[model samples]
Target: MYDFANSGYTTVVITAVFSAYFVGGLAKGAHWATLAWTSALSLSYAIVMLSMPALGAWADLHAGKKRLLMLATIGCVVGTALLAWTPRLSGTEAVIAAMLFIVVSNTFYSYGESLIASFLPELATAQGMGKVSGWGWSFGYVGGMLALGISLGYVLWSQAQGLPASHFVPVCMLITAGIYAVAAAVTFSLLPERAQPRVDRGIGAWQQLRSTWQGARRYRDFVWLLACTVCYQGGVAVAITLAAIYAEQVIGFKPQETMVLIFVLNLAAAGGAFTFGYVQDRLGHRLALSITLVAWMAVCLIAASVTTKGGFWVAAAIAGLAMGSSQSAGRAMVGVLAPPLQMAEFFGLWSFATRLAAIIGPLAYGLVTWATHGNQRVAILATTVLFIAGLLLLLPIDMKRGRAAAIEKSPA
Candidate 1:
């Protein structure tokens, strides 16, 4: 339910609707919008990268995941709701405000993701981790699909009523915020916290972070997992951050067409998430991740080479499949490897790795696009290198050894 709630924010406000709207409608053009969007994302992730380890350590020490989750969720909801007002004003000031709103909301959403993920190991056994993670991802994608559908329906309905098309974006943002708050209530009500005693009540954030850093050498497999995740997720972040803009700019998709494309992608992604979850458990995380990385490479190649809309659609479908599978497998791997007593701290490091990827990937893509005068195809293809790098890193990881180390180190 938490995943479902957050997915609405991600899909409606970040990925499917507002990003393109920000670029096309608010930021004035793709070139500036892309630069602004990437900058905002880089700033947000930089904050997360610096703070996540401390936040995770604090959560671990204080047993405060649920509390932190609630706080982050509220932050996202409020930030998204405020976006509805962005369209009411027009000027350089409004554009900057809108971008700031997106950055703040996305930061909260990312923090919520990390906090909720820390609960995974407590929710499922190691053998069942893949399925549980997959279910969460599938559910999130369903939420995304539904959220996009709602936004699309609103846009169509407003047009049928002869309302200005410009009014649709704000209304959709409101709907997204409402959906997130209502759906997230279920998560807060039903999910168990399973609190653990504070292991280091006196531990300061910096000390905890430093200890986590030093402990990496002792947990080599977990460190390797983080390295692999950083590379592949860098590729994934590029695809997610740029997909809508890519469709609009490169493929000449209208806003309505882009929404529909995202809707279909969400459906495909749900199936991929579920299937890969089963594969993760049966075939193991490393194999599942490798398969997804290979699929991502194909997606990048296809996206770069495709000229026709139909070809792009095909690429989108492949991307959808790989995106869901890769993310689900990566989260499940963290659950499988994190020491039971230090789940939040480990997942914090997970967030750091992911946030770093978030920073690097979009910046790289945006910089390349800007340098080439808005040539997004080359930038899209460049992500293939990230996936290849990740795949090479994954090949050396020993999943069994990682799991064993977690068990051995766990205080439980």
Candidate 2:
């Protein structure tokens, strides 16, 4: 349910509406707008990358995941809602305000994301983790589609009224934040915080983070998992952050049309996650992930090659399937491999790796776009290399050994 709630922020703000609005509306379609948007998102990811592992460990030590989750949830919801005020500022001020607000909101959003994911191991056994994680991700996509659907309806209506984006996009922001707030209220009311700590108080979370790296070889497969995530999730990050921009820029899609496209994409993602959950458990985690990475590579190639709108839709739908399956598979793998007592801490490391990828991927795309004078095809083509690299790294992982080490706390 938390996934259901928080997915709205990603769907409407990060992937669909606000990004397009920030780049096209507020920035007046400035050449630097796309790069500015990616920079702001990357800045937030960097903040989460640096801070979350220690915070997760602290939450474990103090049994405060719920408390911290509450704080993060409120911060994100309020910060997102406040984005409605951006359009009221002067043009330069609005751009700056949007960037600042996105940084704050997305930071909190990422924190809540990591915090909620840490609960997986408590709810599902190792053998069942993949299916359960798939269910969560699948439902999360439904939430995303719902939020985008609602926002799209309003955007269509407001366009019919001949209102410009300055008026309507703010309404979408409020709508997104409202859904997030109401839905998260349900999550907090029903979800249990079940963490039991076995940490040494003298070894603080920061020290543990350092020692975790120092003892990297002890968790070799897990480290390899992170490495693979950085490679592939970077590709995913590019798609998520730039899909709307790409549609607007390269495919000549109108704002409302892009929203509708994304809504359908979310539907595809939901189906993919739901089906692939059981498939991951049956086929083995690494194999399922490798398949998704191959699919992602296809997405990059298809996207790079397509010039027409129909062709782009095919690429977008395939990207959606790969996105949902790959993200679910990775999270489930973490659940199967993390010690129960250190669940949050390990997931925090997972969050760190994911966020770091978020930074590198979009920044790379942004730079490529800038250098090529708004050439998105070359940027997208470059993304395939990340997926291929991730697939190759994935082959070396032995999930059976990783899970055994989690249980035994010794090298496999």
Candidate 3:
């Protein structure tokens, strides 16, 4: 249920609706909106990357993961709710307000992901972690579909009533925020916190940082996983952040068409995530991730070459499949590799890698688009390179050694 609400925020606010509104409706042009959206993502990721390690370490040391998760969730909910007040592109002030809200909300959302993920190792055994993670992601996809469907219904109804879309966009934001808050509350109420062993309280942030740095040397395979994630997830972030805008500008998709496409993508992604969970457990994380990366590369190629709307839909389905599988495999790998006591700290690094990818991928695409006078096709093609690079890095990883190291290092 929590994943469902969180997925709603990502699909509706970040991926589909508000992103298009930011470029087409608010920023009033593709060029500025691209710059604004990427800039916001970059700034937010920068903050997350810098703070996550310390926060993760602190939460683990104090056994305060749940508390931190709650705090981050509240920040997200409040920031998302505030987006309801975004002015309808009347002027520069409105654009700035919208961007500010998105940045803050997105930061909170990222932090929540990291915090929640730290609990995964406690929730399931290594043999079953993939299935649990996959289920969560599947639920998220359903949430995404529900949120997008509601927003699409609103858009269709508003158009029928002769009302401009700008009037309904903010309402959609409010709905997303409400769903997230309510779902998160249910999760908080029902989920039990795992017990943590006592640790020395005198350990300072600097010591924690040094310990984490040293642990990286001890956990080389885990470090390799993080490196691979950086490359592939960078490409994934770019594809997700700009999919709607690309369809609208390049393929000439209307807002309604884009929503329907997103809805279908969510359904496909749910199946992919659910099915791949079994694959991850049977085939192992490295092999599963490699497969997904290949799929992502294929999707990028298809998206870049296809000129027809029908062709783009084919690419979207491939993307949805790859997206869910890749993310589920990555999280399961982290659960397998992280030392049980340091789960939060390792997941924090996971967030750092993901945030770094978020920063680099979007900024690269945004800059290329700006320089080429809004030519996004070339930018889209560049993402394939990231997937290829990630696959190369991942091929050398020793998943068995990584899991062994995690078990050896875990406190009894």
Candidate 2 on 1-412: residue-level lDDT in tens? 9889999899999999999889888999888988999999999999999999999888888778999999999999989998999999978999999999999999999999999999999889899999999999999999998899989999889989999899988899999899998998898999888765546567777887787678767678998999999999999999888999999988999999899989988998998999999999999999999999999989999999988999999999999999899999999999988877778889999999999999999999999989999888999999889898888888878888888778776322
Task: Give the least accurate 10-residue stretch of model 2, judged by summed lDDT.
Answer: 403-412
TM-score of each: 0.98, 0.97, 0.98
> Candidate 1 on 1-412: residue-level lDDT in tens?
8888888877777778888888888877846679888889889898888888899888888889999999998998999989988888886877888878988898998899999999999889999999999999999999888788999999888878887645999999999998899999999999978977576577776787798687777679899989888888999998888889999889989888888998898899999999889988999889888999999999999999999899999999999999899999999999988989888888999999999999888989999999889889999988889999999989878988988988895566
Q: Which candidate wins on lDDT?
A: 2
- In the predicted model 3, the residue pairs found to clash are none
How many clashes does the backbone of model 2 have?
A: 0
Model 3 alpha-carbon miss at residue 19, Å:
0.3
Q: Which residue segments of model 1 deviate by more than 4 Å?
A: 199-201
